[model samples]
Target: MKKSLFTFIILAMVLNAFTACSSKASKGGGAKLKARFEVAGMCSNYTFSVIEGRINPALVEASWTNPQTNKTYWKAFGISNPCNFPSNIKEGDTFYFEIVPAEKDSKCAVCMAFYPTPGKKLNIKVVQ
Candidate 1:
């Protein structure tokens, strides 16, 4: 009877472990991808560049890239820096931003301000 009880406990522990792992995976295990973008160029209140092989100003342009998959995504930014208005970025400077799917198909992306430094990872939740 003791042996049977021990076996049952072990099986229960194993099942619990598997359930926990699966739950974490479903939530992406808190995993986020870092999407990288280069500052192709900047214009009046806007920047131009190609992300994920797609031209800028797209209705659904890449606003961020997933580091894990290196995949680009589009998210909307309500407010962004106006640094690019007067053209402050250099030729090869890289900037990161977030994007969201537009309600309607258009040829423009709502990109946030461009950051000269590629320091910490970009967070789509916070616009900076």
Candidate 2:
């Protein structure tokens, strides 16, 4: 009786572990946002523009106005600064991605050139 009880308890734990792992795997990595690789900058710096998905205003700092036309446009958080381009993705390729805030300690060596319409510095994780 004792041995059977122990075996049953072990089996229950193993089943629970398998169930948890499978559930997580099925969920995939959260919602993916569609974006297009717009350009590559010096020092491996890359930028991606949002192709689909609602833009979050909080992620962008300021709006730009075309003086000639007097038309103002608000840049959304979709513009991101992903310093390193993904191995398989190239400029102009539309792909799905998730924006992850850069860790406080994360650091990258890049050129000092100023890029116009600078994007928010965040980590971009490409989703297949």
Candidate 3:
């Protein structure tokens, strides 16, 4: 009976460890940047043509105007499908969003092609 109880305890601990690991992994074990942006316009190849070569024309270009500095910071999202575009947002609308690296130092060509200009290899999600 003692041996059986010991085995059961060990199994329970293993199960708990697995559950914790899986939950953390699914939640994206990383720090995410949360910010708000005012949609400036849709990004096009012409926008990045000189700076970073041709790019995915479907990207959304947005900017955050710093209240303190009164400067605007720009970034672009690689969301290509028009259907996936957030229904609540429109051009010139300010929205909250989060940016997380797709992977550590991930340099996705399609997403990061406009580097040094306005694009980066990160996953962006609207925060509703």
Which prediction has the highest TM-score against the true structure?
2
Quote the RMSD, in angstroms, for model 1. Answer: 12.4
Per-model TM-score versus the true fold: 0.29, 0.51, 0.29
Q: What is the per-residue lDDT of model 1 for residues 27-126, given as tens digits with 9 covering 90 to 100?
A: 3233222222333322322223322222223223336553434644453111233322223444344443343222343344545564332122212221
TM-score attained by model 3: 0.29
> Candidate 3 lDDT, tens digit per residue, 8-45?
99999999999876655444333233333333232421
Stretch of 10 with least lDDT, candidate 3? 44-53
- Stretches off by above 4 angstroms in model 3 are 1-34, 43-71, 74-83, 100-117
Which is the winner by lDDT between candidate 1 and candidate 2? 2
lDDT of each: 0.37, 0.55, 0.41
Model 1 accuracy (lDDT, Cα)? 0.37
Q: Model 2 over residues 1-128: C-alpha lDDT tens digits?
A: 99999999999999999987655433323446677665554555455555675445445434544333454434423333444446688767888766655557656565767544334544567775
Better of 2 and 3 by TM-score: 2
lDDT of 3 at 33: 30
Candidate 1 TM-score, true structure as reference: 0.29
